[model samples]
Target chain A: MFYFILDILGTIAFAISGVMVAMDKKLDVFGVFIVAFVTAVGGGTLRDVLIGQTPLFWLKDLTYIVTIIGAVIVAVVFRSRMSYFKRSLLLFDTLGIGLYTLVGVEKGLAVGLSPIMCVALGTITACFGGVTRDILCNEIPVIFRREIYATACILGGFGFFILRQLPLEETYSYATAILIIIVIRLLAVKFKLALPNIYKST
Target chain B: MFYFILDILGTIAFAISGVMVAMDKKLDVFGVFIVAFVTAVGGGTLRDVLIGQTPLFWLKDLTYIVTIIGAVIVAVVFRSRMSYFKRSLLLFDTLGIGLYTLVGVEKGLAVGLSPIMCVALGTITACFGGVTRDILCNEIPVIFRREIYATACILGGFGFFILRQLPLEETYSYATAILIIIVIRLLAVKFKLALPNIYKST
Candidate 1:
């Protein structure tokens, strides 16, 4: 039940963020909805597809689809107040990546992937929605270029594994791992940390 | 046997195109290989996933992976004379889309999708590897912005259905569909056919 609520909130956050990005592109109404839909579901869809999970998560459960639509509509309707919710939105987005990371890691474990691959899958689930959004909007993905987003997920994944080796319960390890990701991301943004410039000075 | 040959040829062409694009960006060796691999197999991978085909086409068959590696190596080795092979490359790429479009359509049909959705799937297969390539390379996909690529696949899909209704053999319809896509694409390029400018003057 807790995970389910977080998933819905994450879906809503992703959908709203997607709307914000699409609006920046001045896309048509249909274009905006499509972008929002893809943004909210693209990561999970890709993860499911990669693992051979057929019918897809969203297709099986209408919750994600309905949540995204509602979120998009609300965001679009309250466009003028977006800036006021920016911080809140950021919080929700951070929570999203945190929960999504665990969801992916668990899925990878179910498939019996190596620990490293599981971490990679977790990061993909957390970050690749934004990757898809950037691709659709014709820009380098923020994570690829500068953000500490995937790095936070990776570190959290390591934490998850480390905690699993301890005497802690699985729930404790899971929640602690999520908290680690959230803290890392929040602190990274708060301190304005970024990846080193990969391209040499022109 | 014929389909297998066409599939290999299509894989080679797509891989070569990926290498060419990655080369233009001056990416590193690993990056170039990744782009090429994705370009060669990404479409079919996506098609299989959507239809619930597990293990992916490339995973099930080592042929595509081997073929893409070979194609990329050759393209990179002969990079200095790339312009000289531009026309031959173009022809090969056209053949690729023609074949890939049918491949996707057949997959969709196998899963009992309607003709229209199957056409959409076919176009996705024919064109989205380039989309993935462009996204990775940090640019708008050429097809989404400027090419007649997906349009050719779509028109050919219509031709495929029409040919099927003529009491022709399945082989004849299939061959005719591929031919339609190739001919339309060649003509479009030869005549500089393009979707009308969607973006107005800034």
Candidate 2:
């Protein structure tokens, strides 16, 4: 139940972020809704599909969709004041990603995938929503070019496996993994760290 | 066996198209291969994932991967003379899309999805590979802004359903649908038809 609530919060944060970006791009109403919907659920949808989960996460439970729609509406209504809540949004997003990575790792383990593929799946679950949003908006995915966004998910995934090998309880290890992701992302942003760029400035 | 062969031919054509595009973008060899792999298998992957099919089409069968790698190598070897086979490539891509659409529709029908959703699955299977490729390369999807690419698939999808109502053999309807997509695409290209522009010029 606690995890479900957190997942809803994360979905709300993702949808709001999508709304903000779509509005910035001046998309039509349908476009804005589509963007928000995808941002909120795209990662989970991909994960579910990859694992052969039927009806999909969103399709199986309408709560995620409802939350996204509500979030989009609220964000759009409070667009001018959104800046004041930027920190809250960012924190939610970070928490959301952390939880998402854990969820993905768990699902991969359930499906008997290799550890490496599980990590990859975890990373995909936490980050690919934004990737799809960027693609739809006709921009390069920000994660591919900069920051520790995906790296945080990957590290969190590896940490989960490592923690599992320890004598600690499963719940404790899962909590630790989420914490690892949240802290890494927060610290990375605070320190302005980024992945190394391959292309030199022309 | 014939359908499987057609699928491979489609995969090879898609991979070659991806290789050409990645090469044009000056991506590294790894990047080129990734593009080729995704282009050849991405659509089917999405479809399979959505329907809760396990192992994925590529993962279940090595033939698809081997064919894509082979196609990439052949295209690269003949890179300079690729212009000579442009028409042939286009035909193969058209045929591939047609086959892909059919495959998607069949999968959806097998799973008992609604007709509209089945058509959606078909279109997604036929086109999203190119969409993924363009996004990775940092360009707007050409199908979204122009061309009858998706339209052809959609029309073909509806055609398939409509034809099912007729008192004819199943094979006849399937063949007609594929031919419809191919013919529509060819005619649309030859006449330079496109979806109307959405944005107003400043």
- Model 2 chain B TM at 0.97
Tell me the whole-model lDDT of each prediction, alpha carbons only.
Answer: 0.84, 0.85
In model 1, which runs have C-alpha deviations exceeding 4 angstroms? Answer: A1-44, A47-52, A56-131, A140-202, B200-202
Expressed as tens digits, the lDDT of each residue in B1-202 for candidate 2 is 9888889889999999888777766665545766788888888888887776885656445687678879988887788788899899989999999999998988899999988999999999999999888878797777888889999999999999999999999999999999999999999988999888776774
Cα RMSDs of all predictions?
A: 6.9, 7.0
> Cα deviation in Å at residue A13, candidate 1?
13
Error of 1 at A147 (Å): 14
User: Chain B TM-score for each model?
Assistant: 0.96, 0.97
Candidate 2 lDDT over residue span A159-186, tens digit each: 9999999999999999999999999999
Taking all chains together, each candidate's TM-score versus the true structure is 0.61, 0.62
RMSD of 1: 6.9
